[model samples]
Target: MNASVLPYREESLCFGPESRLIATLTLPGDHPDSALPAALTGSAELPPPHPHLHQASRTSAHPAAAGRAPQRRPPGLILLNAGMLPRIGPHRLNVELARTAAAQGVSAIRFDLPGLGDSGFTSSRLSHDEQTRAAIEDAMTLLSRTKHAPDRFLIAGLCSGADAGFQMARDDSRIVGLYMMEPYYFPNRFSNMFRTLRRLREYGMRRSVIRILQKSRFTRRHDPAADSAPVPQAAPEEGVRAAPTPQHFAEDLRSLLGRGVQIKLIYANTLMGHWDMRHHHRHIFSKLGHAPHFDVELVPHTDHVFTRVEARRHLIRGMAAWLRRIETQQHASAA
Candidate 1:
């Protein structure tokens, strides 16, 4: 909310075996206790130093070691790639969010997953979910070496990245919160109807009705000959199918809430294919209405990728507000 400017520093970091990942760490230079190791400076061309450098720098820059009382480390925030768009996010959204968050005392990292952006491909034969979890763990390990030594973290992502963050939070206890933007979800009947009406209103009723009638006819007239000719056995479906049913997703959310993990689900108005508005979530996941830790926010007049300038500004403000609220709540609980 304050327009005050805070100085910050940025450094490129490489992690994982042979330094496979290329990540950028941003710290609030105004914070006396916030300092990064020299080895993490510059670009991926600079090979990471020994593990001892992490420990030595962490110890020397720690507030307690400097004769001051140990300060509680703010929860680190990690921004993952939205689909394959890279860590900068659509229209450099992640970069702006990280810089704004840094000014509020929240250190942030934006990184590419293996084979995305500037990061190297992962040689592991594991599934995508496994690879995502490993990538997040490596990022956490790197963050732990900083002067803050943040014990807890928040992971934010859009679309596929949001899916990865949700799965990771489900598996790892260190992940305290999740910011999911336009995450994949199955549309319920009410959601479907709402989307239809919204489209009709936006595209003019006559055109929408014509399109819907045409689509219905196409679906009903599926080639009878092709249907009868498909005697060959088909291979089993590979790769993850659509996300679980709404009930199952609700169960997962309940489990996370039981673990005291906070979650924020943001839906762009333009994301009518999956979700349209707040009630869509309530309609899909009835139990979510009772979960205080889970929240759903709707950003009106914004596309899924948030490319417009006003949309980007609204997103950044929403993110900053959420981070500040969570940080304050955590500090209060600790006190």
Candidate 2:
């Protein structure tokens, strides 16, 4: 795909001194005077703090320039993920989202978690929880120092990153909106496990299940052509349950609503082993009395990673449309 048609620019950024988070910052064609909105992706290794030397340099040079031209810092949209995969599946999705958002005047960013990508290795330094939250905090701090400080913040996540994104929305009042794509909250490698277990159950080959997981890793090895994705031998035992009740989607939504933040969650329509991810999504959202400042959407025929180019585009377009709606409402309300 020709990338030049995309609206955003890729940038290298860090939140703090000990942090090595490489983020892509995208700005609207006309920025600064605009109401800034940011989107962030989640990562497993939280980013440490860093100074906005670029923003600082501009400010220092403009001591006498005050309202002269006003720094046109871009509104931000951040992408959060636990780690980098072999291919840029999620990264491509986020970049497309940023491009679409920028077309409509929203700035977007997608960054590697602390230890991933060009950032220094803190890879296994923090738990998924700490890393995710820290990434959000870093994004917020960066936003604050930019020309668009105080602009509303929007966050988006995938898989474990989504789990952390929800946690950040609950903890931070400044986050005005959230979008989650294919949140992997199902217990264990629920979908894949279910598929494998069901296949084993039907064939009455329970013993072979372990062997399959072990052997599959060698054959799969991150190949896009592999029929079965590679799995680590030590990859947590199959069918293991997730801790803390998987952060009930409803509860997370309620928390965001209570703070007056809008949240949109999208789940993949795939069976997670014995568990149906779609059913879980329904169970969580059906009980909500009024959408709880949250909206739920399901993307058909898409997997957790959203690797297919068409699927990625669809996800990005959906996000762009929702963001535009939110911006329109905010503008109308302000007017």
lDDT of 1 by residue, 61-176 (tens): 22235675656678888999987788899999899888877766777889888888989987798776777777788777777666556778998898888888888888889899
Instruction: Identify the runs in model 1 with alpha carbons over 4 angstroms from their true place.
Output: 1-6, 31-70, 190-241, 271-286, 289-292
lDDT for model 1 comes to: 0.73
Each model's TM-score, in the order given? 0.75, 0.67
Q: Which model scores highest in lDDT?
A: 1
lDDT per residue (tens digit) for residues 1-335 in model 2: 22333333345555443555566665543323222332222112212333453332212221233566543333356667643541123646666666677666666666666666665655456775576566666666565554335355787777655666667767767678878776645444355667766567656776776667677766656756555756555555233424345446567666667777777778775555224644555666555668535676777766667756777877877887787777766766566
lDDT of 1 at 261: 85
**Poorest lDDT segment (10 consecutive residues) of candidate 1:** 54-63
